[model samples]
Target: MSARMQVRLWLWQRISAALLAPLVLIHLGTIIYAVHAGLSAAAILGRLHGNLWFGGFYALFVLACAVHAPIGVAKMAEEWLGWRGARVTSLAAVFALLLLAGGLRAVYGVVLS
Candidate 1:
């Protein structure tokens, strides 16, 4: 990859990390609240169902994750695993696709269906 592309990916990873930090906190807090409130599965689903805001939030979260994890993994591979060049990037691409596919499916099930 070109140096410019690598820099772009680095910037994206940082941006995504910044976005995800607050989101993760909110997500965990919500989980805690739901568990404390003894919210049943049906109740949780009811809350999420047809909620555009919830869907959008999760979609953003998933997108950020898709962008973030692969870059981090690629960096890890380069640093710790002594892997680099196309192989590392190819694996990151695959990981990103899997994350997107699964995360979007989950978003569909919980918020759209």
Candidate 2:
């Protein structure tokens, strides 16, 4: 990647990390609160049952995961697999799509279905 592209990606990664920090903390705290409140799976599902707020939050989380993981994997591939250039980026793109598909599937299950 060009230096400018690398810088943009670096900036994106940092922004995502900044956004994710509170989200993850809130997610964990929500889980803890739910369990402490004695919410059963059915009860929790009822709360998320067709709710847009939870759905949007989860979708955002999945999107971030999709963006974040491949960058990490791309760096790993560069270091460990000695892969770079077009091949590495292509692989990372594939990895990102895989994450998207799987994550969105889960998100759909929780949100719409």
Q: Would you give me the overall lDDT of model 1?
A: 0.95
Compared with the true structure, all predictions reach lDDT values of 0.95, 0.88
Q: What is the TM-score of each candidate against the true structure?
A: 0.92, 0.92
Q: In terms of TM-score, how similar is model 1 to the real structure?
A: 0.92
Q: lDDT by residue for model 2 over 15-79, one digit each (tens)?
A: 77887788899899999999999999999988997999988898888888888878888889989
lDDT (Cα, tens digit) per residue for candidate 1, span 1-113:
68998899989999999999999999999999999999999999999999999999999999999999999999898899999788998989999999999999999999988
So what's the TM-score on candidate 2? 0.92
For model 2, the superposed segments whose C-alpha errors exceed 4 Å read none
Query: Candidate 1 regions off by >4 Å?
Result: none
